[model samples]
Target: MPVIGVLPYFKDIHIEEEDSVALAQRVVFPRPGAFNIAVLALPHLSNFTDFSWIERMGSLHVYYTDDPAQLAGAQLIILPGSKNTIDDLLYIRGRSLDRVVVDAARAGIPVVGICGGYQMMGLTVADPYGVEGAVRTVDGLGILPVHTVLEKEKTTVVRRFRFGATDGPACAGYEIHMGRTEAVGGERPLNYVGEGFDGYRAGAGCWGTYMHGILDNRAVVEELLAAAGAPGLEIKWFDYKKFREEQYDRLADHIRSHVNMEGIYRNLRLQKR
Candidate 1:
């Protein structure tokens, strides 16, 4: 039997219940915005909160949905990291969403994959040691001409790297996974870590990488948006580090400075934006 996480409830909206809580925790509707982007919320989807900053972006509305119809209108599609790549890949095939994604890719919608999602975008994933559960080999989505071999050894590291070329934007992120992938087709390299290349990119607006938080950087986000056909998107640069500092300061103010009761009252009295 598959395990499921508890469905979250927000405000006064009641979520539709389903047989399994995992699949039931469905669609994350679009926020007030212009661009409509969709992300595949794979079963055992991990590090999804990495997109929190993206969700807060004013011009970008992210939809975390499994329905193929909802995906039809997306400018860009994202395949997020999964805890169990093979099983989640099977889950996607079971739901018949693999065809939807492939069709979308064929129709020119930009698609990107991260970590295990990166693995799934390849040609084949061979798990001879059962590192991610059952010992098996399976064909991937074949979006990228790459092959992955799952192993017992896992790679976990944090580093700052550039997008392969000297003129490419600088990016920082971490890697955590149990497979090593190699490019088999004529796909362009995605990024340069320290001494070697570490991702695959194609002219078809498809990208795959093992790095997490690659989208957190402003440059990468802008580049991806431009490729997705929203060339003139005006995305406000959000300093995530600065925002964290401000939040920490606010928390300290509440704890050390007598709760700032009058300040809260003054804010409440101000007109809404």
Candidate 2:
């Protein structure tokens, strides 16, 4: 088993105005032997940019992986939200990656499924609208004994949700999914939206939620790290809105440094010529 260490919470990091720029730059760079996290890549993946927050925290090194072998050293695995859940699941199974995730979860590695990833963790998922052009029930990984049905009314709302009895921290995020999940065997629901199932936690290590923008909540990441057995880290309390604005500014700076916007624009102009 990989030895887990708890890092200090966010509150411990005292960030001065002058240090913010340096901290953001340093966070974007991966550290050697840092805790590795594998994010399962889907063809229709979105919101991958959110991972910048994790990287800035310095506790996790995130990588994209579709290969099952990559899961071996990952302390935590993230199944990000996808536009095509059925296709992604089938692609993973076809590559024998489904077994890899199940094996990892069974071995007590932390696994998080968000939105479509959440649906894949259930017993069965039914998409009736043919949004992804598939209307069939598929077997889930069964990490959580839940069932999800895609409804016509798509949920795209930002709201705050109260976490119940969880060890990490209180979390709030935006929901952007069409399917609603229900626990079949009377298990406690992971998330609650006025008595409806919004998320589920299988054990101390594995958790899934329907919220797409949960990463916007630094408290959520801190709690997740704590649950994953990271070293005890201090928690920083900040206005969530202000924190998000800071993150966005930092992200813009990161992109300016790493991405060649000028070169891309020149190339586009040349192509137009």
Candidate 3:
């Protein structure tokens, strides 16, 4: 079993100032965890909210870390979406996490990547059209037998897909990426989207998918956590839309019953005194 430790929420690193103004804010940590997951917070990470719901789950402790050493205790490692695949792949190599992630997967720790992270898990990524940066080919993590060729036209769509070769439920997610991945060495796919395959699963603990909200489905998440050795953790079947709707209704009721618009107006009038 991997060593699970409760660490600080996020590192206190200096974020460069942009035209947008900001101030220091509190970073909320997850509850007491049964499973520890480390997410690679790349420089241009996007669509990170895909994991926000899972972070709120009681059974899992998800933290974003850039240090390769932090991969030691993580039972599952997630390579999150990035705006720039080539640059982020280089960043992972620079941090020496490429080998670390590969070794972790080989050791039976489940590894998952979303979007650009999926691109990095392939055998090779060729950006011939310079969709991201320079027109170059970079070696991927090689966990999966797929190769990606970035195209000028981006694919953005929302669809429901059945899990490929697994007993998992049908998952619905959106795809927003600029590359098309093709399996070259007959690797099993992760899911089937429309008439085509969408992802690849390598070995017992490696998975790469273009789907963004793959983990949002209850059945999929449960199966993954169980494979990562965090079985029997309570699966809180949450309806996120219903939760938001109830919150909105509760806020409206509170305002209609307890808020004092007249008293506020009178108070504002008397504030001159």
- Tens digit per residue, CA lDDT, model 1, 1-273: 432222333343222223234445544664445598888877678876457577667788877877777767688889898888999888888888889888988888888899888899999989998877864998899998999999898899996889746558888888988999998755477888766778798753688999988878877787788788887887766787577567666555444444445555566789454
Better of 1 and 2 by lDDT: 1
RMSD of each: 10.4, 12.3, 10.7
- Model 3 clashing residue pairs (backbone): none
Q: After superposition, how far is residue 124 of candidate 3 from its true place, in Å?
A: 1.0
**Per lDDT, what order, best first?**
1, 3, 2
- Candidates sorted by TM-score, best first: 1, 3, 2
TM-score of the candidate numbered 3?
0.77
Off by over 4 Å in 3: 1-33, 166-168, 244-273
Which candidate's TM-score is highest?
1
Between prediction 2 and prediction 3, the one with superior TM-score is 3
Tens digits of per-residue lDDT, candidate 3, 85-122, equal: 99999999999988899998888899989989999998
TM-score of each: 0.80, 0.72, 0.77
Q: Name the lDDT of candidate 1.
A: 0.78
Question: TM-score of model 2 relative to the true fold?
Answer: 0.72
lDDT of 2 by residue, 183-217 (tens): 87676755555445468877656877888767667
